[model samples]
Structures are given as structure tokens and as C-alpha cells.
Target: MTDLVVPAVINLDVPGPVISRHLYGHFAEHLGRCVYGGLYVGEDSDLPNAGGIRLDVVEALRALDVPNLRWPGGCFADEYHWMDGVGPRDRRPVMVNTHWGGVEESNHFGTHEFMALCELLGAEPYISGNVGSGTVREMSDWVEYLTRDGDSPMVRLRRANGREEPWRVKFWGLGNEAWGCGGHMRAEQYAAEARRFGTYCRDHGGNRLYRVAAGANGDDYAWTETLMKQLGDLGCAHRPAPFMQALSFHHYTVPGSWEDKGDATVFDTDDHYRTMVAAARVDELLTGHSNVMDCYDPGRNVGLVLDEWGTWWNVEPGTNPGFLYQQNTLRDALVAALHFDVFHRHADRLVMANIAQTVNVLQAVILTDPDTGALVLTPTYHVFEMNKGHQDAASLRVDLPAGLPSREVGRASLTTVSLSASRRDGRVLVSLSNLDAAEAVDVELDLRGGAVADVRARVLTAGRLQDHNTPAAPDVVAPRPHEVSATGSGLRVPLPAHSFVTVEGRLA
Candidate 1:
């Protein structure tokens, strides 16, 4: 062992912030096969489906206990027209999806179909409204159509489309990326539009809406500053206006520059180390935005929502460039664990977060093959399953001892080991990751303030960092039982190179 490596300590009795289950939220956009072929395979196909929505995908997401599903667009939300997708499927309008591959879109998976998918998964529906080219009336009418009742004009329109009852939608987004694809609007321009559009999205028939303003892009603090100053700040200290409850921003982990992101399955130890360096920027990004928010709204009344996040690599070869299909690797799993740890610590300010796309897209948990209808769970999926205990649990503080193992890349130096812990229902869960590419490291955990018993551990890793799953070999990078040894005052845990481990036990 190197002299720089040292032990760590965790105070389980001193529980910190409560991690929001909504932090484990997901996003499904209308680009490429994400909607048509990825989530919906039609009722006529041999695959199991209900009302043209695939059951296999629903069943998989249910296992994750998904909190919410954001739908209908990334950039596609700006140009989407809600009325064109309701009523009869055969009678719905067909339009071109100019943003993604310029492909023609059949308005088959509309509002009702999306609400049905949410029902099947037991997840909340977070619908992002059209703002770039849509009007105030269109946004207001869509809200009424989904939530209003008592024979209102929009309710009657919804009834003619065959839904007798209204759905209770809690989360609603005003727009997406107004600085770019949503529109070329300045920060001030988007804020004024958000204020006007949010005024008319009324709550009706007991359905309350949580209006989230589309916030900054990446590390654009000026954008965040503009929104905080202009919208909903009626000035009486901590209270923001009712129309705007939360604000959202986006960040993605790209291994290389945007012009040329490296391939998913082709990489080396150096690449793996460099990727961890890129992933560590998430902590700085969240802190930068949260600091700016604190200066304006000191009471933390307005919640920060990271609605779009995850890794983005180049599309697989021979695939459409806009489809965003990439293979998931062991490195991807570590990136997910690293991000969640930062999110757990920032729970006080950050209320919700959603990974980019759930199926057949960038950093997807489930990928459906084009040739065969077989579904493969990626390494990223196993990370979600292992860390599910952290959802809504009270986050525990984990800290490295002095002189802990550290590795330097560029101007950044990161600890070789990353750890996050939480307590819920008389049990404590600890998730640890080793970022060293070629060597195993031992972690000594000094457990304090609680009597623990029956500790169990599981690990997810592969022979190579780039190893991923396919239909032919599904269990290559899956989780299996790991070993944990007892120490005089605590426990000694050993983790392999490029691996993720989880330890769980009940409090006595």
C-alpha cells in the first residue's frame, strides 16, 4: 500500500439532509427511436404490449421505482403542438422531426399515451410545455385538457378523445434551453416569456401544478442570475411567486470535446482516468449555480432542478448520428455513482434530477436491439438498482482521513475512492467506488454512533473497463456478492480497480 492511502470514517447517527427520490428521475425525448421504436413497439408486434405501449420497458422501469418521467421533447418540445396528437391515432397529424435526423413523426404517442405509460410504471408525469413557437393559449389549453374537469371546453375536448377522468400532473416545465435550440432568446427574454406563460397554467379540479422555469445551460451563471432576478421574485424575502416553484439546468459528462466525443467501447486506462476527471466537474458545476442562487434567494424557497444530465459519447458506428446510441461500460457505472454522491450532498438545494434518456439513447439504462427485439440492461442500470436504497433516505456524511490516496489529472486532483451513505427504515446503505484503473485498494471505515449487525456487500465490475452487456451475454458486468471483513474498531473493505460496491445492514 502507498503511504498516501489512508482510512475513512462515517458517522451514521448524525444523519444529514434527506435525499429526494425525485433525484432518481428519468427523461424520454421524442428524438429517433426513443419514442417510436424504443418505448412503443405497437400492439400488433409479437412483443408484449398494452395499447401500443411496450410492457417490457414498463416492467423494467417499475423495478427502478422511477419517481417521474419527463416527456415529448428535448429540443422537440419547442416545436411540438399538443392538439395534433390527440383523438384517434389514425386521424392524428404527421409531421417532420427536424431537430433529430429530420425524420417524419406519426403523432401516435400523444398526451393520453404518455399518461398511460406513467400509470403503468407508477411514476409521475413531468410534461415540458412548448414555448419557442407556441402561444400562451396553447400552453394553457393543454394544461386544462389534462387536469381540468366540470365540462370545461378543454375537458370536453379531452372527453371526445376518450378519457373520462383527468390526470393529476404535479410537475410542468415552461420550456427547454431557450438560449439555443428552444429559441435564440436572451436570458431576459426567456424570463419575461416564462412569467407570462406561467400566469395562465391554472390549477383546476384539485390538480396542482409545480411550474419549473427552464433555467441555465451547463455553467451559465449569468443565465441563472437573470432568471432569479427577473421572474417570480416579488421581493418579500424567501417567497417566490406561485407560478414558478422550481428552476432547472442541464450538464453532461463528455469524455472529449463536443466536436469529437470518443467512442463508447473503445478506450484505455488513460481514457478511464481522464473520464473521472471530467466527471468530477459536476461538483463544481452544482456549487457554482447554488452559490449564485443563494445570493438572491437566501431562504432556499425556490428549488433547483437538474432535469437533464448524464454521459454523452459519439453515436455507434453505422448508426444515425442524431440517434445518440452509445454502448454502456464499467466506466459509465462509476460515473453514475460519482454523480449521485455529489447530488446526495447537495440535497438541501437540489430537489430533483433526471438522466438524459431512459432507452436506446445516450447513457440509457435499457437498450433495445434493432435486429432482434431483445432488451439489454446496461451497467448503468445495475448502479441504479444497487443505489435504490438512497432514494428518499437521510444522507450520511463520509469523509476521507488525512493523506488519503489522491490522483492528479490536469489541474484537478481527486481521491482514488468515492463513498456515499444513507440511512432509512432502521437500515444503513453505503456505496463506494474505486477510480484507480489498475490496482486494488483497501478502505478502512470507522463506523460510529450505532450498533450495526448482519452487514452484506455486493459489487459491480468487469475484467476490462470497457466491458459492456449485450443480448448474448447479459450478466457480464452485473452485481454479485462481495466480501467485508471485521476490524477491531470498524471494518476493512477491499475494492477492485474500476469497481462499484454497496454495503447494507440493519441498525441494532
Candidate 2:
């Protein structure tokens, strides 16, 4: 028997308040079948829908307890014009989605459709403004059109468009990427441009805006440093010159070749370890970016919004590659858990995080078939559903020592068993994942101050390392509840290799 002794007790209370709910937010770009056949099919379709939004899909997302949904685009966000999506569907302009597949966008679903979808799912709407190919006045006008109520032209337009009320949108993205498709502007240039664009946005009564600036790409420390240095404190920067509340970051887990991003389902052991290492980079990026923010604002008021994240790979066979469509599997589930673990640990600084696309796109939670009118949930969807309890909870750090063995693949490998604990409503919930692809992990939970009775647990795993869920077999990878015990020293749980687990302990 291998002697795996309990490491030092992880005293998470040292820093205090580790988990934040906005970190659980999601994204929905108008790409591929994601918007067309995936989420919105119009009431005319054979499938049951409410206000043109898929009912089954809405119910599924509601079940997952999605906190927020970001709309328009990744690059598409920068090109979208709010006015084009409003008014009579027949009268709305028909434009080509140049950034995604060059498909025709009939403007069937616009601002009202998206906001209404958020209303149905009981999730907040995060609007991404056009910055790359839009003017300052255009973006500011969008804010007024959706938020302003009394006598503004935007409000009048909303009344003319058949929706007489305002959306009261709070979370607003200044732009997306900016370094890449968002304009390819230098850091200093984008900083100045951000200040210019953000200046005109108005804050309507009833809804306080949380303006998010487009942040750096993965591992781009210089980008974060430049923005923080140029813009100053973001969270507290309500001075109107450059009103900013959060900074945004985008990272996708991709293998060496962007063309051949390994395989979505069939992969060897090396690929398993490589995925973990790629997913784990999010933690380092967060840490490095936060340190840069610390240099600018030592008070730590500004927030880091991981607005776009998830696994990116070659499209599933027969799907549009540019659309970023891929199958979800147990491997994707582990990636989701790893990100949640990272977010939970840095909850205080990481205000909001959204998985790349919700449906029919990169790392989607739900997938649909237009011909068959079928709907299915993916393994990543199960991971999100199981971790809903972590929303808006205080993070309590668990003890994890270094020297934990990791698998290395081209300088990337799995290291330690990452865990994030939180306390909310008389319950302490811990979300953990073992990055190990081979060995089972022995975890000891030290719930000294908190009550530790009747620990209910849910886990997502599979028989094979490369196990995944396909349209043919959607339920293959899902969460199953089990009972876990608490001991005198702590709670001892054996985590299987390459698994995602969520444990809930009742507090007295």
C-alpha cells in the first residue's frame, strides 16, 4: 500500500472571502448554430419554444443555475449594432455574420430577444458593446437605449420597437480582444481608446452599470500591466473620464496545433495530462494579472472578469470548424472543474467568468439537432449543474501541499489536487478535481470551525480516460450523488483519477 499521508491543514480563512458568484457566469455568441438553430428557432419551428427561445434549452440552463449570459459575439460583439436587432423582424436589416461562417443574420432575434431569454432563464444579461468597428456615440447610445427610461431617443426607439420598458443592463463590456480582432490596437492605444469610448456611456437610474474593459490574452502580463498603469483603479474608477468596474480576460484550452487541437473524444494519456496543464494556466494568469492590479490599486477594488473561457479544439466531424463546434466529454468536465477550482480560489478578484459558448459552439453545455429537433446536455453541463451551490458563497481555502506529482507534456502537466471550499446558508460546499490521469487521490477535509455532518457528494467521471458525451449518447457522462463520511481528524474521501467532485457538508 502506498503511504499517502495527510498534508498540512489548509487554513483558507487566512485571506477570507474566496468565492464569488459572478465567476460562474456564461457566454452566448451569435455564431454557428449557437444562435440560429441552437438557442433561437422562432415560434414557427416544430419544437416547443417561448418567444422564439427554445424551452427545453432554457429549462436546462435554468436547472444549471446560470448566473449571467453574455451576448452578441466574441469578435462579433465588436461588430454588432444594437439598433440593427431591434424593431419589426421583417424591417430589421439582414447582414452577413462576417466573423462567423459568413452566414446570413436575418435579425430575427435582437436585443429584446436576448434580454427576454435572460429573463426566462432567470440569469443576468451581460452586453458586449461594439468597439472595433463602431463609434463612441454608437456604444453609448446602446447603453441609453437599453437602460434609459425617461424621454431619451433610445427609450423612444424601444417604445417604437414594441418593447416599452428598459432592460436595466448592469454588466457592460467595453470591447472584446482589442489586441486581436477587436482592433489590433497597441496597449497604450487601446487604453486611450477605452477611455474615449467609456466616457460617453450614461448610467441610468435603477441599474448601476459595471463597465468591463477588454483585458489581455492568456499569459499576456504586459497587457494587464499596461491597462492598469494607463487606466488606474478600475473598480473605483467611477470618475466618468474612464468609468471602469472590471477588466476582462479570455483563455481557451487548446493543444499545440490550433488546426489539430488534439481530439475532442479519442485521446491518449499524454493528451489527458496536456489538457489539465492548459486549463490550469488560468490560475497563473489570474495570479499574475491580480499582482499587476495590486501595483496600480493596492486596495484591490478592481475586479478581473474572465468573460471568455473553456476548451477549444477541432470541430466535431461534419460541423463548421470556424464556428468552434466540438463534442463535450468527461475530459471537458474535468477542464470545467479545474476552472471552477481556480475561480473559487480567486473569487475575490475574479468577479465574472463565462464559458466560451453555451450551445453548438466551443465547449458548449448544450447541443441541438435541427432536423431531428433533439436536445442533449454535455458533460460540461453536468459539472456546471453540480457546482451551482458555489454561487455567491465565501471561499474557504483547503490545505494542499506542493510536490504532488504531475504529468508533463511539452512543459505542461497536472500537478496538485486543487480544491475550493465555501460556506453559505448553513452549509459548507467544497468543489474539487483531481488532475491526475492515473492515480486516485486521497483528500482529507478539516472542517474544524464549521459543522461537518451528513456530507452529500456528487461526482462526474467515466470508465475510460477519454470518455465523452455525444449526440448519440448524451447521458454517458453525468453527475451521480453519493454519501461521504467525516472523521475525527477530518473528512477522508478518495477521488478517482480524472474526476470532478462536489461535496456538501451540512452545518449546525
Candidate 3:
């Protein structure tokens, strides 16, 4: 039997930084069906679409209150040329997506189409510039084309293409994965390249560009230290800096080695346990990277952007291996909940995080069937929808008792319960997850600095660890009302085994 932990206390009077709503952001790459079949069905398709984008997927994303979306590539962003994608679709050039699946890509969904989708979803567009295979002139001109309000060659080109009013794009990434697929450059080499490319990415009108530098991969502290040192030297010398606002890091939770990532839906108890342990490592990664940044940036000027993160597993059987299509299980939902708690605790230094490949890809929230026009909301989707209250809310410090009892999985051990709390509009919201796969634990909630008037809760759980939503049965794992009662001192709720729960209450 798993030990029942002591009550977790939340001090509402003490508030931390406001959690940036951008932290709940999503990513839509140009890979697989993420763009063509999942999000865009074309203007001539029989499926209901608004300007080539599927209406159902748009409505589902809107419900999550998605704050921002990163676009165009993981590796695709590096090889992509902006000019080939702009003009009339019929006249535009066609290219193969060399980095992802080697599939042919029509220049139909270019800058204009992406901006239109952002407008429809009411999300801020974050465009990743091509620094690996693109010239400085190309990147600079692309920014000028989208943001320049004045009369210029690029502005004329935009008018010729179609859009008259310039769409505002604030966030700009200098490159994606400069250390690997993005040119395989050394840390110092990439630093100089970033400065060169970022120099001409000028601000246009009201859009002040926030340039994000490509950062370390996983626990590569050497990479983090090298870039920080080089940038700091340039800043101290009074040289023009690269409008650098944030540094990005990519980390995915893989239960095993990259070559043999465990199956998404065929996992047993041990596989499930190991996955949770791996997801919990995000806290360590953030702390190690933040410490390195502090050495060069004592004031914490540069924010940490976890731009790509989620579980990566073997592709579903018979699916195109390069397409990276995998089913999201209950385990994926817990991983998301764990990440949310970690992000909230470090909201001061970490500003934004986007789950990798938002649709029809790794750990996707929404999956669709092209032939039947059927849509399935994965378990991970419910977790995001339930935890939407934490966006931009004031973080409340949570106090968990000692001996929380770490569970062992393979060679690693992790705490059984992960938690985060926040207060907003006289309401306190607490999110909790029980990592144990077999034993349900009773958690006591002690509220300080306030009295609870009423309480309500929602939980996501299933009969089996591998249970997931399929196109035929979409409601297998979804949010359901959970039992909550107000104790004399606070509230008490039972956290089911391998479950994620969110409890909200009015303050008295």
C-alpha cells in the first residue's frame, strides 16, 4: 500500500509572479498532417473549412484559450525559404520537406495563410526564421514584408501578393536547433551567426520584435554556458546586441533511448512509471540551465523558453514512420499535468512553453481521421482545458509535507504527488496528480489566509494505464466531475491512482 501523504497547504496571501498565459501555448509544425489534413483541408475540400482551415479543429483549440502558437518547422524552419511560399499558390514553387518524411510540400500555406490562421484562432504568431540555409538578407526581408508599414519593395510585394494591412508578429526565433539539424555549428559559431542574422530583423511599426536565441539541448550545460558567456562579453563591450529577449531549449520525455522509445499505447506498469520519472526531470533541467544563465546574466534579463517539449514514442503501427503519428494515452495526460506544475513553480524565469507538434504528431492534443472527418480529443487535451485557469493567474506557494514517499521505477525514483496552486479573482485553484499507478491516495488540502465558500473538482482517469481515446470511442478518457468536500479547516479530496485533478473554490 502506498503511503497517504499529509495535507498540502496553500498560502493564498503570498503570491508569486503571474503565470504567463503564453506558457500554455501550442506548436504547429509543417510536418505530417499537422498542417494539411489535421488543420487545413483546403478551400475546395468537402470538409467544413474557413479559408482552407478546418472549422472543428479551430473551435476545439479556441476552447483551450491557447495564448500563442509557434509555427513552420522543427527542422523544416531551417531549410524553408520564405519567398517560395508567398505569391499565388498556382505559381508558387513546390519543394520536398527534406527534414520531415521527405514528403512533397505545396507552397499553398505560406506566411499569409499562417497569419490568417493565427487571426482566426486569436493567437499571437511566433515565426521561426531560417538561419541555417537562409541568408541574412532573406530573413530581414521576410520580417520587413510582414511588419513594414511604409512604402518599400517588400511592401509592394506584399500588396501584389494580397494582404494590404501588415500583420503584427512580436516573437521571432533566430533559428531552430542550430547545434544539430540547424547547421551543426559549435556554440561560439552559432552565437556569432545569431548576432549577424538578428541584426537586420528590424522592428516595424508597433511590432517590437522579441528575438529568441537557440539554446541548449536537454542537459548540455556547456552549450548554455558558452552562448551566455559570448553574449555577455558583447553586451559589456557596448556592442549592439541582437534584440535577444529569450533563449529556447528543447527537451522531450522519452522512456528509453531515442532509437527505441517505448510504445505509446502498449505500456505496462513499469513503462508507465518510468515515463513519469522521466517527465519529472524538467525541473532539474530548468534549474541547471537557469544557474548557468545566472553566471552571465545576474539580473535574469533573458527568459527561458521551453519551446518544444512533450512525450515522444514509437509511431502507431502501419502509420508512416517519418510522419511521427502516435496515440496519446492516459500516461501522456499525467505528463502534461506534471509539466504544468513545474512551469508554474518557475514562472519567474520561464516565460513560455509549447508542446511539440500540436496535432497528428507526438503527444498531440487533437487527432483527426481524414477519410471519415472524425475528430478525437486525446487525454492530454482535457488536462490542458482543465488547467486553463492557471494562465496569467497569480501563483500561490504550495507547501507539501516531508516524506512524500518517492516511488521507484527502474533505476530512478520520483515523488508520488505533483502539485501547483494559484489565486485569481478571489478564487483559489489547485492542481494535483497522483503518480502511483495502483494505489489511490487521500490528499488533505489546508487553505491559509482564506476560507473556502464552495468547491468543485474535475479529474481524468481510466481503467487501464494504456487506455486512450480512439476515433470510434472518443470519451474513454476525459474530464469528469470529482467529489470534493469542505473540511472544518480546509478541503479534502481523493486523488485516484494515475490521475490528474483540478480543484477550484470561492474565497470567503
Candidate 4:
């Protein structure tokens, strides 16, 4: 029994800055086919590619309107050197990825290639700097090579490599997980290091750099406090200067055990409830981290970037665990929508977030079969596509009337339903989710002073909780279009249990 009611008209007039669709950002690392075969295939393959990147995948991401992409990492960003991946591909050096799949990383997909891929997808590129195993100059020079204009050493190198125009990359990360894969440094130490490395990142014309400093992992409040203090100190007359515009946080929902991580495609009601509970922590993490930041910067100049997030589970049997590739299920779709709603509600501080990986990796949107030349769209992909109407729009704080508890059976618990409303291009989109395993939600959406018509919905659900798509069965969990009508009381819809629905209405 889950119910939500509203007593007053909610004013959504204060549209925040269009949520950086980058918060809906995707990751691409040099692990497995994620680089070599998944995204970049070297221009010689017959896999329907453009300049070595998969055409179908690019088309899919473009349709979803993915705004930005994070490159060369998770853990790989810490050890990557920008110079090794530039210029001639064959002449480039190959380094062994110490953390992911322990596979050899060819310098084939370097800065130029990444920027090219971004052009194909029409998305912004957010390069993660190597602060863990790299020097201050390396970080600076990499920025110059990507953004600097003519006459600079890095710019000359860019021209020599066939790219005369500087790739206008705006978002950059100083480090990833400084406490773990990014070199085990204390918050204070990483904060100081971040100021130094970020100082030299030039803000080339039209490329306003959003330098992200290394931040906390999960609910680590001290890390945020310590880093904020250091940043404040550097900005004052006492130090080199604060160059960071944002701070990053990484959280993954790993049920059962962190090491074992369970499975990507197999799980029961208990596992589902526990996963939602764990996923709900993102809101807490963002709220707590924002509170700490407010203490340091009350005016809210610094933004919180949830850069690395998604579900992490054990690898499939016979699959390389470090590759981080797994099947995406309806469960993952709910997790994606849940996180998206949370980020939107906290849009003031939670500026950007990148899902773990884009392809052939954790929570990937597109999965390709090298053997069959087939591509499968994961359930997570449809959620992003359906929710595209919310990108870069103002959010309305929902006043959900007192509702029944979602459902609790043993250790399993559900939130019943969660809501987020946004307006884009004259359409009001209300995203509703029935998180319960067995109860469908009868919802009444009150639009207050506004009227809506030409209503419709795109429903994402399946017969089974663990249902997913395969190369052989690509349309398993696809969106089903349905007609809807707005009532005088509000919009009424029967949200199927364990399903996600996005109701769209043309403004009247």
C-alpha cells in the first residue's frame, strides 16, 4: 500500500541550470572491447563503424542525447599518461592496465581519438587527469594539448598529429579515488595536490574548464571537510590558488559482498530490496557532502560531481572480472532512474554524474557481439532515453501526500513510489516509478495552475525482475508507448508494479 497526495500547488518556476546532461555522463576505459572493439575498432573493421567507432552505438547514444563522456578511466585514469596515447597509433606505446582486466592497453584511442568520438556522438568530453601516478607538468601539458591555441608546444603537437583545431574540452578531473586506485593520499594531501595540478589548466576561449578535484568515496564526510578546508586555504593569499570548480564522489551498489558482488542478471526480491536500499544512499551521500560544502562555501560556488556510479557485481563465469562487463537488467533500469531523480532533486550541488561505463562494461547502455555483428540495448539505455526530456530543465519539488509504506517483507523493503517532475521544450514530463515487487501504484499528478493535453507514456518493464536483452534478443525490455489523459484533479495513471513510467503532456 503506497500512496502520494499533494495539498498545495507546487511552483516549478525557478528552473535551475539545465541539469548538465553530463550528470547523465558515460565512461569509456581501455578495458576489453570497451576500447578496442566496443567503441573504437581501428577503421578497418566491417562492423558498421565510422573512423573505428561503432556507428550503431554512436547513433543510439546520440538519440538518447548523452551530453558528456568521461574517458580513460575508473582506475585506469590514475595510471594513464596523455603523451603515450597521442600521435601515430602504431608508434604509440602500450601499457598494461594494472587494475582493469590486467590487459594490455594500446595507445590507439588517445586524446585525438576521444575528441573525434565525441564529435561523432555530439557530446562533450570530460578528461580525467592523472594525478595519482602523474606529475604536475604532465597534467598541465595535457590540458594545453587539448585546449591551447596556436603557437604553444602542445598545440603544435596537436597539429602534427593531424588535429589542427584544439578540441574544446571543458570538464577535467584532477584525480579519481585518491584514497584507493588513484594513489592512497590523505584528503589534505590530495587537496593540496589538486590545487597545484589544476592551477595550470588553461581556460581556452569557449572552453571554460570545470576542474574537478578528487573527493570522497560514499559517505566519507571527513574527506569532503578536509578537502574543502584545503581549497579555501589555497584560494586565500596563503597558497598557490584554488583551481577546482567541482568535487567528485564514487558510489556503487554492491549487494551481499563487495568482493563477490553477486550477479548482474540473477537476483530475487531480497536482493532487489537490498540493492534499492544501497542505491538510496546516493541521496544521503550527496546531501551530507553538500552540507559540508555549504559550511565551507555557503554561496554554492563549488559543485559536487558524482563522477563514478552504478551497480558493481561479480563477473559472469568464464568472463574476466576486471573487464567489468556484465548484463544490464530491469533492476539496473530502476537504479538508473532512481539515481537520475535524486540528482535532479539535488541539482544545486550535484552538478554532474557519469555512469560507470558506456559499452561492454558495468551498467553499459550498448553491448555488441564481435562474433555476430549484433548490438543489444540494455534496459538502462531505455531509461535514459525516456528521461531525456528532463535534461537541462528546471525541477519541481514534489509535495507527495502522506502515502503507505512501500512494502516490507523480512529484510526486503521498497519505497513504493518516488517522483520527479521537469519541463523541456513545452512538455511537462513526470517520471514515476513503482519500486515495489508486487504492488502497482495508482498516482494522481497535480499540475496546479497549468493544464496538459496530448498525453502519452513510455513504459519500461518486463515479465521478470531479472529480464534483460541479448544480442540474439535485442528488444526484450524495450519501451512500450501508451496513450494517457489528464484529469481535472491531475494526471492519473496506473504505474505497474516493479516498473518505470515517464508520462509526457503537451502544455495547454
Tens digits of per-residue lDDT, candidate 4, 56-99, equal 88898899888989988877899999899887889999899889
- Each candidate's lDDT (Cα)? 0.89, 0.81, 0.88, 0.81
Model 1 lDDT, full chain set = 0.89
Give per-model TM-scores: 0.97, 0.95, 0.97, 0.95
Regions more than 4 Å wrong, model 4: 1-18, 233-242, 409-413
Weakest lDDT window of 10 consecutive positions for candidate 1: 230-239
Higher-TM-score candidate of 2 and 3: 3
Off by more than 4 A, model 2: 1-15, 233-242, 401-405, 410-413
TM-score of 2: 0.95
* Model 1 agreement with the true structure over 216-299: per-residue lDDT tens digits: 988999999898886445334656777788899999988798988887999887788778888878889899999988877888
Estimate the Cα RMSD of every predicted model relative to the unseen true structure. 1.6, 2.4, 1.9, 2.6
Q: Kindly list the per-residue Cα lDDT of model 3 for residues 296-399, writing each as its tens digit.
A: 77667778899999999999899888899999999999999999999998898898999987899998999999679899999999999999999899999888
Model 1 / residue 488 / CA error / Å? 3.2
- Candidate 1: residue pairs that collide: none
Which wins on lDDT, candidate 1 or candidate 4?
1
User: Which candidate, 3 or 4, has the higher lDDT?
Assistant: 3
